[model samples]
Target chain A: MVKVENLTVRAGNFEISDVNFEIPDGKYGVLMGKTGCGKTTILEAICGLKNVVGGKIFVSEINVTALPAGARGIGFVPQDGSLFTTKTVRKHLAFGPRVHGWKREKVAGRVKDLAEDLGIAHLLDRKPHGLSGGERQRVSLGRALAVKPGVLCLDEPLSALDEDTHAEMVDLLKRLTAENDITVLHITHSRREAEQVADLQFRIEDGKVVQM
Target chain B: MIGARSDKPFLAAIGALAAMYLLLIVMMLVADAIYGFGVVPFRSDNPDQVSLVSIFSQKEVINSIKLTLYSCTISALLSIFVAVPTGYLLSRYNFPGKLLVDAILDIPIVLPPLVVGLSLLLLFNHLPTKDANFEDMLNDFKVPFLFPKGIEVTHNVLGVILAQFSVACAFSVRTMRNTFDQISPRTEQVAQTLGCSRARAFFSVVVPESWRGISTAGTLAWTRSMGEFGPILVFAGTIPNKTEVLSSTVYLEITTGSLETAVIVSLMMVTIAIVVLVAVRMWDRRNEGGLYHG
Candidate 1:
């Protein structure tokens, strides 16, 4: 579960004021907005990647407002996949588990499972630069899920995908979220994408989040 | 047919100009290497003149070469150590007086090398004397190590290292800053969200990504330190076999009218610099190729 209460954030000259929302446990919540409507900002704030000027954030009933991003137990997949270019897909998948102090064997096992689930087992030896757009997105998703966080925040994960690839990814995301029991807060500008995947929907207008 | 005919002379002229510029530089270096020292080919008429073999075997010259190599290596490492954190800070954060700090960091680069050396010499001259009140106070508080006495930076190895570091670090910082600027902060943010601490994220992600920049900075600093003369001359006096680096040795040889020895040392410096530059180019090409394929 992820909850934001009266959260205010300022990024450069843009501001998101008095935002409030929640994704119930194990549900897919989509935040839809036009370009630069602060959807990504809210996701960043919830994951502790952005500083909150005011108000609280709760993750799994724990008030994580003051916590660092690392301690918040939120997996974030930024737009563009942002995979470490120097690392192989295997290393990318294993990075989170390794950082979280999992045993090497456990990390390896988790990486294998995630790779299989994401249908990226064949691309594990490849680097991000070698992967196609969809392949890169799968590697990124695998990396985020490696730590087994309670919440996954994705920022326009399918924006760069073709129509066919986007639909496939949406289905994969829905299935994976349900199977893993992970609450998701996915941001997108496309209303169709939101309707396709969201259990609950929120729209951002003028830096404010309103339930739809 | 008319347009093609007209373009021929223009292209040929520009090509000729480019080739001539490159050839002129190469010819100058070759001419200096072969003739600047007044050495005649296949002739031993001037037996009194210092031979290249004799200069290479000279204890002072050999020692200066070693000192230059050692000091440059140490100073380059030190510059990188200081540059990494400084570069990251300058790139990532906007703190109070950030612009001022950035400007100040560029001071040593723009300041005359002689001025840097002179400033260091002056600074060392103000080191606390053994009987000074500050030293006495530290001794009284059982913290004498905090401000030790009798430490001399001028005319010492420490002085050479300091002088080189002062200028080398500025170049390194600029290189690394450009490096960090090109990398996306989101990569690090994603690392943090994956449970890595800020320091861990920096070490594991940012540092790895900037390896090319670090290498470029290190090479630039090392080469700059190797060529440094004015500051080292002022702050660290060219004491034979002690503070004498390759550049200083060249100056000393020239001052003593041993032009042959000076030219030999200059050739050695040029040779080493060329090798390093070629290696750096190869590394860059390999990295670029990796990016293209990966």
Candidate 2:
């Protein structure tokens, strides 16, 4: 569960003002906004990547607004897939476990498990450049889930993809989340994508969420 | 009255220039081919003189090559550690003196080698060996490299390393900072929200995304360090077998009238350069061919 209240972020020559929203545990929430409406900045502020001039963030009941992005326990997938290009798919999955200090065998097992589940089991040896867009998104999603965060934040995950693959990826994400019981807060400008994946919808216009 | 026009002269001029350029290139190839190996031929009759096999086989020459390798590698690694962080900070965050840092970094990339060496010489002067200001500062710190005072970072291999490190680092940092600017900071934020520590997020997410540019920067830095002549010669001195890297070693050999030895050393440097070219091509392939396509 993630709760963000009175979130305000000030960057150079731009500021996102007075944003408030929530994604309950195990539910899917989508934040829809047109370009430059400060959607991504909200995620950055919540994760502590951007300094919030005013706000509070609670992830699974702990106020983590002042904490660094890494301490927030919110899994995030960028629109670009943003996988580490240097590592193989398996190695990428293994990264989260390594950061969390999981044992070698445990990491290996989790990677294998996620590979099978995400249908990327065959591409374990390949790096990000070799994967198709859908394949890459799956790997990025798998990498985030492998960390076992309290909430998963996906920023425009399926935007660049073609229609068929986009639908497939949406379904794939739904199945993965249901299996893991992960709460999701996905950002998108596409109303159709939000309709496909969202359990609750909030629209951001000029830096404020208008619930719909 | 009749008028005629032809593109002949312009085409001919272009063809002539092309031919001349090709000839110049071939002449370089010929020179490389002719003196590439020593004048002694494959087998020579002078036991006093070191043959190709001997010059190529000498532990000193080999050691210099190996030392060049180690020094270049160390310089590049150290430069990346400092360069990447500094470059990222400078690129992403703006504060007072940012422009000053940018100006200083660009100096090494533009300055002539001789000027650079002279500047390093000035920096190395008034060693804390006898300087009161540096001596007092040294006493406050507990580094072992200095004597009871500041002793020898200059006139030693350390001096060469430092000189090359600073110059190469500046070049690399500029290139790397551009690479960092290309990255979407959103990627890092996403990684952090995924429970990655700041250190881990940088290592896993940001570094990998920018790996190609960083590798190219490292290569450029290393090649510059390897080919650096004036600075090492000025500050470190051309001490035979110790501070003698490939460039200065060739210079010393040629000046001492060891023409054959000099030629062999030059050939060795060429071979090393060829190896770097092959490595760069392979690195390019990996960067383009593989993906975390996200």
Best by DockQ: 1
C-alpha local distance difference test of each model: 0.89, 0.81
Of candidate 2 chain B, the 10-residue stretch with the lowest lDDT total is: B140-149
Q: For all candidates listed, what's the TM-score of chain B alone?
A: 0.85, 0.80
Tell me the lDDT of model 1 at A84. 90
Candidate 2 lDDT, A53-151, residue by residue in tens: 987888888999888777777777888887665678888788778877899999999999989999999999987778888998998898888878778
User: Model 1, B44-135: lDDT tens per residue?
Assistant: 44667567766776798889988888999999999999998999999999999999999999999999999999988877756666666764
TM-scores for every predicted model: 0.91, 0.81
DockQ of each: 0.60, 0.37
lDDT of 1 at B188: 97
TM-score of chain B of 1: 0.85
Interface RMSD of 2: 3.6
Q: Residues A1-212, candidate 1: write the lDDT tens digits.
A: 99999999989998888999999999999999889888888889898988999999999999999999989989898889998988888899999888888999998899999999999988878877788899989989989998888999999999999999999999999999999999999999999999999999999877678899
